[model samples]
Target: MSEFSISDIGLKVGLEIHQQLATNKKLFCNCKPIESEEYSIKFQRKLRAVKSELGEYDPAVLFEKLKSKTIVYYANSESSCLVEQDEEPPHNLDNDAKDLALVIATSLHSKIFNEIYPMRKTVIDGSNTTGFQRTMLISQGGQIEVDGEKVGIQSICLEEDAAKLLGDKGNIREYSLDRLGVPLLEIALDPVEGDSKKIKKIALSLGRLLRSTKKVTRGIGSIRQDVNVSVKDGGGVVEVKGVQQLDQLEKVVEFEAKRQFGLVKIAEKLRNSDFEGISKRENIFDITENWKSCKSKIIQKALKDNSIIKAIKIENFSGMFGYTPFEGIRLGKEIGQLVKFYGIGGVFHSDELPNYGIEEDDILIVRNILKVNQNDAFLIIAAPSSKIDFAINSIINRLEEAKKGVPAETRLATQTGETVFLRPRPGASRMYPETDIPPISITNQELENATKNIPKSWDESLLELQKKYELNSQLSEQIFDSRYIELFEKIVGKIKVNPTFVASILCSTITNLERNGLNSKLLTEENIVKSFQLLAEGKIAKESIEIIYESIMSGKSQTIDEALRNASIETIDEVKVEEIIVDVIEKNQEIVKNQKERSIGPLMGIVMKELRGKVSGEIVNNLLLKNIKKKLGNI
Candidate 1:
């Protein structure tokens, strides 16, 4: 635990959720909003930062411009067009997407704008080919309640999703245009001060509300969350981008709170010790010669590759890099994060020295060369000569910010819930009026139509689901929240299966498989519906559904027939099932003789063990009872 609670630190969090809308066409193009696996078109472009209407360039765009990276794009005609390539102007606003946004806005009680103007938000990360993203503010000012506490909605905007980043080389990044220009609905929430659990609950409430509308797309990559976290009297607001999982939201918040608090403590300690910040001229030294004869494999490899080793000294900064005011919080990790952007693996600091293959002898040599002192700390990096000065200058700049609390920046969320520096946070200078598309005016009839699409309240929806499906509250809520809710309804409507069973398998069983490290996403909607269809036709038993799902998700099989063959599961006839039941009874005659009808329960296990995926348990049970009674009469 930390020295202070969440309230003690004055933690504030704001959430911005971006949900993909299920529309038939792209937001500004006629192409379908679909991702294609195959690409037939390819092109490359270099984007540059430009002044906004106010004659100001976004700091983030300028930062990316400094890298001078080339962006290569892959496109498929089925999902992209000239608009995505920036060769043609955008078409009129997508009406279906606009209506969906209006429905969400009306449902949230937000005031919709009479005329929506499109604006270009500068983005030079290669995710956008035009060097900017087109967005429109459709409505503003609404509120949602979480646990009896109200959190305000800032604004609702409909925009185009960016292209998917495929890979990144040092000077080049590859992207796919398949996802570009897709309709996206963004919901921004006002900042709220609370603990991690409350923050997570607030996010969940917002997600559930969108899902209740049933107009948003489902599955991974269909939705993303950008979390803005700041601590009072601590660092500036930091944005963690692309958090796709709800379970990871709380962890991201908790980790960020600790990180900002730790930075504040480090800043205070530096001020208390009367330490001056790092100066590049007097503090940096080239110590490549010191590691030429080292035994460490990393050093030897770097040396062999002609990489230079540079070190930076901080006065009165001893123990600050390793200081942990909170668990897993350290300034060294911050430095490590900055170095990664420059393609450096990591940095070796005095605090973690005498480890990582750098023996005590090597540390002593470095300390002596940098002028041995108890109150000083040093960081060394091994990189190509091209990156040495840039990496060192960044380190000094970051240390300068350390004198203040946390530096304002945008960080990427990792799988482990920790955040890493991506780029400096952008400011309002990024937005300018888009001239390609005209403003859209909302009419009374359109508003009325949108109102009709507003979904029921979450609680009411869950209650209605429970009543309509004759399901328990837990099962109903599970299906209602899961990605398969729509699919569950389709399956139940098309197949002659119990609604509760369909809900359970779609929600609980698939979740269990995912928890076991299986990718349930591999099971397509057609696959599930087809499997249930087979069950309804008595070609496959309910017992075989999980087996088929597991097989398909585990990559052992791709089709229903293949999954059945791989699992050795075939639908045995009722005659065959009765024969197996008779065999089991003959093997356990003494138990049947003693237990009579009670023997059915004990024999169920034996029968299922043989008929597990081959036949239905209901059929097995009925046949076992009938045969056991007939045998009892003979006895």
Candidate 2:
């Protein structure tokens, strides 16, 4: 939906996907990777920007330090240790995780390094309990085909996952250590041609390939894709982090492309303009009486709380502050970023005349106080002294960058498909060897064995399933590519349940349960196998399987018969149902005789209430019809 053409936009996209490996132990320590409910440990710490060897600090680090961010971490002894909490040294790497990464790398045709060296990537964010993340390169320089065109692969790294961030208060961010130190396999790709459609195919192909290994963790938060996008028209590289769904990939790229393109246009227009190099003014003004009659409830409440409304003058920039390159975002968003980073409330600008009830007289007073000409823009923020200063300085810095074209940065994605600043892109200085974990070597024999054990290609498996099972291409492909494929085939081949029913329950029913907040993981593969076996043996009706699944998801661990006995309705014999229908008709004989067809409705409702969940509704309806006809004939 952007104004720019796909080709003229010149978008280049690459992906860095991280998936949790299904290992029994943590990547650095012997802690189990399973979920824990115990509360055993808690600690608080703060991260400071460390100067790189180049004698310079990362811009993002400097930016965060200005906001004074602190972190609080929570841990459980059952699933974490002092190593995860950064209170002690980490142990050697887990070999199972290493082997899994090697298998995946081999499948992608990547050439392994003779020796794998672990590196410490600097992450000052609170997501990592440790200030730095431990990572090691496994392989590099592979390729995959998208529509018969090769997209180059960059490198694959084995890293330890970060802790989960809980929430953030004024200066402190809370985190949970349950997911800390989980083994993560990070696969990077070379920049592909800026085709959004092709980028989508590449992502889907890579995801399916990873799932084919059958050793990666599944479900929400188990996998994440980070995209690095840039344009050839001099826009800086933008990193879009934590993209969870494949469907949103194209839209994200399109938005980024247009955003960069607009920034470039703005920079071109600002060339040789008098507003160049205008520094931010550090002065703060108390405009309480000026906005006394303001219509904005937000500003009025701020006044009541004794919060000051401060405005900064930017010369020669009228009519530009309200310019929007994307929906729901303005140049004002950059100012808002500072407000959030420093824990401020909100801000106002001069480009758009909001219905704030500022009379003509008050506007003249503000202009005279700031000495601003008609060609200038003023930024006004309502907050305490320190936060107001931080907000103004941040706005000036962003405006300066706008003159230089799009600034290269890393941003976080919101659920609404918008992006916010996370940090500046780190340079090569962030990469340093991780001294705790030793280098690992992959032998030739190991690669050969992994290749030999490679599962059948998804396409080949789909074709074989279609011919053998007499199914359509869509159903066959769905079965072949599903994580539940192995269990589905076992159920249909060993048990006597219909293949279609088994497939639908495994794929569709589980998806529906997950969407409805039920833990589909609780209904394990073994649970499905057992439930289908019971259905095949006539111990439960097919309709009752949904009840069994719901019961298990709700923490009931009984067998099919036990589950049924606990929740199912008692089955009424057909003769008993017929007798009940006849009794109901006799009781309503007056209505049955006068309106022969209408009496069946009340009789059917009564019979169904007694036989609910025990017998088919069709059988009840048929028996009700026969008894109603006989009663009317007698009358």
Candidate 3:
């Protein structure tokens, strides 16, 4: 990647943060939000569009309908009910969730709305069984300061989270209802001006403010952010969804800004050209007979299945067809969405040809079949006759969008920080009243009570952490933002362990363990508290705290003694140390016989290995030198 200054690529970012509330039950059902039960039932369904109250359908919803997206829902009786499956009307909203939303709203200094109206936001992607998500605005127009700059808070909405989609194949998508209907508090931030650093600071500030309430769920997927980014040079808005990490958000924004900048440049270069109104030819033809020797598995499979191959003529896009703004995504991804939406396999272009066993003769043959000139790009899609027309239409639509610069679309985020087009951008008008749940009213008394009970602010938390735990400002800030801050305070205040040690492990050591693949989720606050209590009671070595934590994170449910034994970190016995030291001396008799001034390297390595993670390295070094000197007759 080339080095580009922040100013070189105009970066304007807005954040839509969704945090799941730690409610006792699902947003609309009696089932508990935190489910630990195995799924007992599974079923499949397809999403279809219904007209809005204005007697018009949302184009985005209709686009999904054309894709024939099907949904497969997995249910567990203990955690889900008919309400989640859309078979029954929802019960009353979860009050615990509503209360937490108010707590967060008050903490952010947002104005609470007197009447909360529940609305149904259209979602036809099968992530929701009801074809729409239940959402309601609670507060609006708050602001948070980042380095003396005010980052506007647009609104905060309380909504029910959608199901976790496991996977999709053909027209069917698998969903885990285990996470469905959890209450979520969504906070939208107004677009801020600055580089990635400032954007990150703003995001971190908001996240810490939310965590300060100590009322939100903490873990992977418990919180998500959607960023709507655009460049100053002019391009359509692109929404990136499900960004889980704050650091990754900066990278996503930077990358997206550059992507849009490049796209706008492309659009400008071609603006005056005659290719503006070029359209995709809709004529369909079978090219399987000519592609029998094709090496492309996708094409070969279609040929073997006797599927129809449809081609369209794209004008003045010969070399441009292979142009890519991001890795693994070409102009082809835009085209692929069309094919995916239309239930087709994929589309083939003329740019990277002569490779799929498609030779020059095949290219010429396709061009002749489509009756296009050399400067034109031809797209071919393979599918049954049932979907060939839709596929052809989708490809044409995508081509038209490509000509118009970056299309306004929603992209799904990957763990690697890349995004691909999920669907067209949803319109603002897709939201309507959710008739299933009655509108909730926020009483002034309730808001006042919540305000009174607001937790300590971030700066106050830092100061208190410093005063109570003897932590510096930097470490104190880290602990305040850590998920383990509450646990650290509980343990250190209850047990006699060193506060600094506890804080370090909670804020740093455990983070390292998680990066090494330990399941930190299993190591709860209670576990940490109990482990430290044992250490303070002289039941386990102080140095062995991390070892016990590692064991617990490795899926073992053992008492302190069992954990210590399993880790092989037994107390360093005098007899064992003497035996190991004598062995080291006997093996290195050559160095000892010389009786010259000795270097501690060889013996230090042997003793350290034997006592690793068991005793202090300093104690082992001292014992090794004492034993070595005794053997050398220097007493």
Candidate 4:
């Protein structure tokens, strides 16, 4: 990583940020913009690639159509309607959502268009039931500064978010319509040349600017980032999609830069070496007979199921597949990624042979069949007979592209921060004017109102929070960054508690709970408020809040009362608290006489051990000090 430099490679990185708006209704309908688990409507459909008005099909859509998947859509009445199901025409655009977009545009200092026309972007990936996403260009040409360097913003779009993909089984994919039609603001930044750290900083700076508006949704899936990375000498631009976490952004960029660089180097090696390009008849060989009595379970099952086992031979590519100029950068992994798109688990290349139960004898047999060359490499794929042609063609095409540098395509980011093949990059022909909704005219009065709604910057907001609550710098920043800032304020304003404590519980305690394998999301807003209310009313000690929340999250209790019972926290009166303290002091009489004031610490611990959640620690402390002092006078 230290060896590579962004400027040296002429790397260009662009960002497309999609954030869900915190609006009351869906972008095109009156349906509430929320997700629901109970779906009343379920249907399935098969979508195909359609040419735009220009009569050119999007390469991405064509790729999806080739795979041929059945899309199963699930819809709930509360969060979706006929508009989402594509059964009825869309209603008028929601004014609140439009206005919210305007506010963000104003904050970015962008040039807003007077008339906004929605466009249909073709998407046949089952994420959109209508086979397209509705997007409108609201503004264009603005810039944000990160670390004293200016990064230009290209365009800002107000769009309808796609459906949430549930999962996939075989050739069928499931999608939930509960998230469909929600309003999202897409901000595209101009491509910039920088290293991974600078790229991450730019992303963070833009994200903070968006969040400063406070009109966007929070929590997981509320915001998404799509990164387009390309090198000057290293092939084409590769767009990495759905980078949900900022911490993963740097690693994603680093790995992608190295991957593309390595790919370019491999192409150079092929050009200089005695490499004859891949041939269909010569490279694509049917090696099914060689694996008839194989020890490998995968091969045995494929043979039993009558699946075709095809292998491709690449001349003078023995060490090339396993070549890694950089750590974790290899062409074999790249080939495996492309094959998985066709529903094949993976491929076994000659570089990694004599493994996966493919004994040395089996390797020799494949080499003999493919006309053995010491420097040549071969890869085998086992799949259904119908998919053999498509799988082989796809592999041949990828290897061909390997002769060139990287192929321009969209890739999916994995949890490990590496990216894999998703689809080809869409062209300009993928978008056309949307006709369901009319063009909306933006008035000066609306722009003025939106400008007024633009909130303070992140630094100013954090400073205001500190001043208002008298909170320390760290706690204020934590609460501001946490998903519970609004709840923190509500808890403090509604209950008689220290604001700092509230911030800590929301930021630190909940995080600690999640780290300990507890789902703190189970503690709803209502439950959290109720617990604090109980604390203010002296029904439970301040120390008991965490215990009750833990109980609820751990599934030991459902309600506050039940949690209290589970933790055995009974609200003891002052009499009981003093009695417990006196009993503890009498038991530790020697310590009281010897340590005197120091006895206060040891005695308070013993007393609280018995009455932890029942009585306040403050009350126990006062009682222990007075009783200990009186006993010392008597002694």
lDDT of 4 at 139: 97
Error of 1 at 44 (Å): 2.2
Against the unseen true structure, what C-alpha lDDT does each candidate score?
Answer: 0.89, 0.75, 0.77, 0.87
User: What's the distance in Å from true for residue 30, model 1?
Assistant: 1.0
How would you encode candidate 4's per-residue C-alpha lDDT over 541-620 as one tens digit per residue? 88898889899988888889899988998898888788778888888899998999888988878888898788888888
**Deviating ranges (above 4 Å) for candidate 3:** 1-4, 278-286, 292-295, 324-330, 337-345, 490-496, 513-569, 585-602, 616-622, 625-635
Q: What's the TM-score of every candidate structure?
A: 0.94, 0.82, 0.88, 0.93
Q: How close is candidate 2 to the true structure, as a TM-score?
A: 0.82
Taking all chains together, the TM-score of candidate 1 against the true structure is: 0.94
Worst 10 residues of 3 by lDDT: 275-284
Highest TM-score: give the candidate number: 1
Error of 2 at 533 (Å): 7.1
> Candidate 1 on 1-635: residue-level lDDT in tens?
35877889899999999999988789998999667778999999999989887889888887787677899999998889999999999988888899899999998889999999999999998999999999999999999988998899999999999999999988889999988999999999999999989988888898888888888888887888999999987768999998998878888999899899888988887778857887778888888998787778888888988999988888888888898878878889999988887777789888888887889888888888889499899998999887778778878888888878989999999888888899889999999999888778899998999889888889999999899889999999888878888898888777788998898898888889988999986898889999999888988889999999999999999999899999999888888888889999999999999999999999999899878998988898899999999999999
User: Compared with the true structure, what per-residue lDDT tens digits does model 2 show for residues 1-635?
Assistant: 13667688677888988999888689989998667555667788888878777777767667666766778888888888888988789988888888888888877888888788888877877778777889989999888776788877799999999888789887789888989899999999999865777788888788777776767776667888898988776468999997877667777777677667776666766665677655554334567777777767777788887777876777887766677655544566665664666677756778765436555665666677788898887777787655666667666777888777778888776665567777677788777777766777778887777678666555765677778767778777666656677677778888877787787787777777767777776776777888778666655556567777877776674455556777764555689878877877778788788778887787677776666556657777898888787777777
TM-score of 3: 0.88
Better of 2 and 4 by lDDT: 4
1-635: candidate 3 lDDT, tens digit per residue: 23345686666788899988877688888897655546788988878898888888887897788767668888888778999898999999888888888888887789899999999999988889989999999999888887788888899999888898788788678888888899999999998767777777888888888887777877678888998888775557889998988778877777777666666655665565556444443545667676676666777788788797766666676666676544444566557655665667567787777666566777777878778776677777788877787667666666666556777888877676666667788886688997766778888788888888888878876787799878888888877777677677778777888888888888888998988999887776667787777667655556677888888888775555667778887766667776777787778877766753363676677666666656656666677777767776752
Which of the two candidates, 1 or 4, achieves a greater lDDT against the reference? 1
Candidate 1 local Cα displacement, residue 493, angstroms: 2.1
Q: Considering every candidate listed, which one attains the maximal lDDT?
A: 1
Residue 256 displacement in candidate 4 (angstroms): 2.4
Off by over 4 Å in 2: 232-234, 268-274, 281-309, 325-329, 355-364, 384-387, 461-472, 479-499, 510-541, 544-613, 616-635
